[model samples]
Target: MNCKQLQKIENYHEGKLQTEELNFVKKHLESCDECRRYLDELKSQALLLSRIKNFKPTLINPVAFRNEVLDQIQSKRNRYLVVRASRFVNSIIFILTQPITRYSFITAAIVIFGVFIFQQTIIVRKIESLEKRMGSNIVAKESGRPGRKNVDAFFKGRMEVQSDSDEAFRELLGNYRSLQIRYTVLLKMLKEKYPATYQEILKELEEAELLPENINI
Candidate 1:
């Protein structure tokens, strides 16, 4: 019959309490006069509230209220699905394109490599031919030198021939070195002048072994 028990008056009148709770409040109200009077007043107020008319126009429509709530929920769900589907499609496209992209890159690399090898082959062959021709020309010149051969002159001619061969070797070696240097310099220049040509020539030099393998920069 305490004031705390009176708090259940609303729930009891509305029939919202569990059976045991309702019985407890009812029993307390029966035993306590103050609690019984308080419960009566609460009942009277609830009955008056139920009979009161407070409805107004232009403020609420139940159909529109339900539709607005449903539309908002439906819109959120549709947007979520669209975002998820877009991400899925983008991922699938990327996966499908990965192998094709890799294969195209590999094909380009192979083509460039082949062209470089062919050019280097041509350059090396031309240089070797030039070296042989130059050697023959040098030998011919020495053989034509005025020597009337006596015992002393014969030995001297032999010495001259050796010297000529030595000169040919030196000259040819020097020309080879010079050509390699010039090729390097031209490659650098071409990189600034024509990048495409420089790339092709660089590939040739690599395959031809025209320069030391470690000679970068």
Candidate 2:
């Protein structure tokens, strides 16, 4: 039979076709056993579907489900945060308590402090030497004594011709004043650190007439 006649079998079985169409499909089915079998199979499938029990779908609360999922996510995040915080605190404790770490830190601090003290001592000694030279110069200048011939040769020659002697002299005096200030600071530090040594040095300078007796050391 033709496919159109075969397709009309379900409509014919349901009494949904006009009399003329029904007669045509019936005539075709009488000659075509395949179309009759197709119609019988469709009827059997329909009867099986009708016999099955219908069940209502179970409903879900979207808000409740969303809240449950969010709670799980928040719990995971909290656990991660706690673990990270614990590791950070443990690292700090380890650094503070480790013998190697403690020793290294202490050694570095001691070295830095020692270097600072050594530098200060060197500065003080240099200032002390400069003070002695400046005092000798002052004594020579006041006594109208000539300075070293070698040292004066260069300046004396320039002074005789350049007319820059006064400026040069002022520059030299300014430098002497700056050295005096440095010496005073170092002297105060020395006195504070070693008063007996400072007093002995002062008395020696006085006896040698390098430092005036009236000046407080």
Candidate 3:
């Protein structure tokens, strides 16, 4: 028998060969001494291996094992995603915390503040300029305007008129009791139209010892 035909010693011993192949190995083993010994060694080895027990634990919970494997895979995937997110956040923080970036933000804020102050100052200056122009124009118009001699004459006569009014007021105050007695209807109308003012006038008259007891108001 050839090497290929002799190699079927294990198959023949294990009953793995077809009927034709089984007959081929069987006849070859009986005829060839080397292939017969090889077949015998294979049988001895099989018997020894079958007799020995496996020391490792047997897999009884396939479903639990599959879940545990999936859990580990998911946990690793989550860890990878977390690591990627952490790296992205760290990159952003690092960029923002950089001296140039921090200073740029500060400079931008200062420039905006300066622009606002400048705009406010310009507005104030414009308002002040308008006020100054208005004052100057008012002064120039007043300087060019002519004075009224009649108004000056009225002012000059006002002191004399004020003295005469003071004398008249004193006389009227002296006759206030008689005036109240004579104009009883007018006093009631004044009280009705201006209650607070009438009360104040009555209070003043009392303070001056001019109000009479017969004057009800």
| TM-score per candidate | 0.26, 0.36, 0.32
lDDT at 147, model 3: 34
Best by lDDT: 2
Task: Arrange candidates by TM-score, descending.
Answer: 2, 3, 1
Highest-scoring model, TM-score: 2
Candidates' C-alpha lDDT? 0.61, 0.63, 0.60
Clashes of each: 0, 0, 0
By lDDT, the candidates rank as: 2, 1, 3
Model 1 residue 182 CA deviation (Å) reads 15
lDDT of 2 by residue, 78-118 (tens): 99999999999999999989999999999999999999999
Better of 1 and 2 by TM-score: 2
Task: Return whichever of 1 and 3 wins on TM-score.
Answer: 3
- Please write out the lDDT profile of model 3 over residues 1-217, one tens digit for every residue: 4566555777777788999988877787777888877777888888888777545667899899999999999999999999999999999999998999999999999999999999768755553443334323322333332234322332233212222344444455345454444334434644775577457645654554434455564
